[model samples]
Target: MPPLPSHEYHVGIICALHIEMAAMRAMLDEEHGTFSKKAIHDHNTYFGGQIHNHNVVIACLPAGIDGVVAAGTVAKDMSRTFEQLRFGLLVGTGAGIPNLEAGVDVRLGDVVVSRPSGVYGGVVQYYRGKSKAGGMWEPKGMLNAPPVVLLTALQSLQAEYELEDSRMPSYLAKMLERRPKMRSMGYARPEMDKDVLYLAAYHHVVGRTTCDACEVAQTLARPPRVSTDPQIHYGVIASGDRVVNDAVTRDRLRQDYGALCVEMEAAGLMNDFPCLVIRGICGYADSHKNENWRRYGAATAAAYAKELLLHASIEETSQEKPVQQILGKSSETTRSEQDWAEQFFSKKQVTFQ
Candidate 1:
């Protein structure tokens, strides 16, 4: 076993779900020929590749793993092996906040980027708080904002989008051409006519396969967005361990913390590493959830992430020390990431020529 060729990874993309990981992998321009060795004590796996001239790495969480502790563990290990990592991205899908007010008509499949607005940081942990009786809860701590380079890129991208529609669709189409699984109907974008915005009080029928059990008469009507492109919304994003599937709770959290989206893994990475969260809106944060649009949502987020990397000019920062200096050992001497994958599940290993 040997350490990688003293090279630094320009960026790392972290995803909690396989669908999201596949989307990120699809954007790789060239996969590294060598397989990465997993850190001795960690269970996470890593894939090496290049995207837009920068060496990039993508890491996926283990099965049934979706929370702060799990995401933080992967982020820490990734830093040790990929010492040259300047910044990271929590790229995945999240539930969208369906508030049609103040000129923000965020819809399903839209991209939500975490950005510091007012009192809240870009990412907020909804469960990191002291709960009291009478439904009173106080937030505990603040999460770290994204690195300066990434933030600058986001600002520039936002300015560009304001002038024109998002370019995610084209990028997504190209990526899908390479990775057909992502374009399957299960992961593919569903029809816009199927996009439903039910009333807050309307509850999804239990043990039903489709939304037919619920009354369409109770749906909410709102003006169609001027642009059908996946709009980008910048603001706080609520993260917690629990899956928020209730509209009442989702709206309350959005209003209380000014969260534009609700997700699960960003809280883990933000405190430990300086990274940005880019979430593709899969569905409304309500009970009528399904996987019809998950694939497309994840692809949109991944495409946006790649676009952001194009704006990042690698900074020669002094803070980055090699893994040998930080972890006291060569990462290559450890078990291979493929070995870890074999122990749990059987998925085809992504290889480079």
Candidate 2:
């Protein structure tokens, strides 16, 4: 089939880093390349492709420029260039906030899916709202939920998993096999012994890969899994700009919002685009964070996203309103954003072709 036009794509996949975007690029069944003509105002360099039966567009934030503001800008540029984009999937890595008593034992390489579980929507801006007496943000995270088609497909996929096993294991392995260099980049799972959860009181020694130098007995012990396959956790994901490398703040997010996962970019796009967030656990939100698991985490998240989109109903997704139309932004906000973009381009001396 000939390549579809830019307007034909409804699904948009975004990543915070190049590592994450590489996995997304590998998921495309048929890559249509980029648009021959792009809007003058849209500066994003999008990769066009097909996944299952759906045509999709993918993009990643520039290097060293990530977090809420950058993520929001990427999504907005996409909606303008690909006018029919119905929703998005922010697929990347996150910090696991493990709470044994609360039954959320998120380990490195595990995938965390954002879905509405309580008062908050699927993604929560944990940094918002006023502080309560004990210092928890008031439950003012009334954010937008993911589009219904994606949620319905998730329900079906979850039910299917109960009767059978997930394809994540095979998918991840296949990615490494097909793209062998990925293994060298730490996309392959590390040894089970490498997955450690040091006690909250213990801090990192710095300039080291693991906390083995710390008190070994201070690590949190849990039951061993039957297999090396990555497990999926469905729960709320807390989003903020601050890099969470401290245990106190990580536990605080869990105690207050029941956030099984914490990430940096989801909250910025969630309110405007109302998309689902898929993240692979790179480390526990603590000072022990390292680069060891980042590649593997990004890979796992991409695998789950591909599976989720395959199960989604194309008919239902096509029927959903376009993201630009659904954003619900006021005219004043729109004008303000336009003015800012204009000033930004002017200062940078961006000349249109």
Candidate 3:
């Protein structure tokens, strides 16, 4: 792979699925230019375009692949190609960790922004620990907090939203209008009335796509929210190697770890990349999982990402001397991720285990 043109693209956004990637790509205000470059090591393509005043590049996994390991490989290759990358944004859809019983009523189509509170960082990987047949477990290591710059920007955005209101809904509306394909029922916003919360033990009927087959009498009664607009929750995000479809496990994890959202990719990126994780809540992390609100959830997260970028400045993100310049290397393929591991994480070893 040849070197990218010596232009500074300060931001890199990564998504796990095509829908998530499309949601973000649709929000580029003025795509002044577009280009694709393959990673020298993995051959994964990184798409580049201009969004607002920033040069942004996005990388996504090939179809049908999902998990932390794949995310790490794509992010690694993306870093190699976009040498001027300052920080990355893992923007995508995830499962909500809502326990109406606990007053944490995160519904479908809401957005969750990982923010550090107490000992937990912005994101935590629940699958990192060891398990035994007796239900015994050993805790795994914790991931570092997101870069200070991202945390600062998140605080600013939160304060601004508190004073007024979120612009995510309007941004999503315009995005759907611009990209009409996202206006379909599956991708378009779902009716707030259809958002249901079923009993954890009452699983969805097998081979059914809709919830009509599930016993409506088993639903959990909760006070309706005043706003249907996507509400943003800030706190720890639970990430693991597998999808959380079991409500029993989801609630157990939520009760145990206080996770606001559940996802599959952010854990891997935590090792070498100091970036923020923003996820839209599409499903309830239960047996009744469906694509009904996934597209809308992804759109909301992408819109929030764009809103956050408006507050970011290149000066803070580019404080570190350019790694490419420091190494005096034209292409990053000459150095492996092991080289970066030494620089980023130091003597501490990082692995998917």
Q: Which model scores highest in lDDT?
A: 2
Give the least accurate 10-residue stretch of model 2, judged by summed lDDT: 344-353
User: What residue pairs clash in candidate 2, if any at all?
Assistant: none
Give the TM-scores of the predictions, in the order they appear.
0.85, 0.90, 0.86
Q: How well does candidate 1 score on lDDT at residue 56? A: 79
Worst 10 residues of 3 by lDDT: 344-353
Reference-based TM-score, model 2: 0.90
Candidate 1 local lDDT, residue 174: 83
lDDT of 2 by residue, 229-315 (tens): 888999899886657777777787888889998888887787777689999999888878556889889999999999998788788
Superposed by TM-score, candidate 3 places the C-alpha of residue 187 at a distance from the truth, in angstroms, of: 3.1
Query: Which clashing pairs does model 3 show?
Result: none
Rank list by lDDT: 2, 3, 1
**lDDT head-to-head 1 vs 2, winner:** 2
State the C-alpha lDDT per candidate. Answer: 0.74, 0.81, 0.75
Q: Write the per-residue lDDT of candidate 3 for residues 226-251, one digit (tens) a residue.
A: 87788888998987666667787777
**Global local distance difference test of model 2:** 0.81
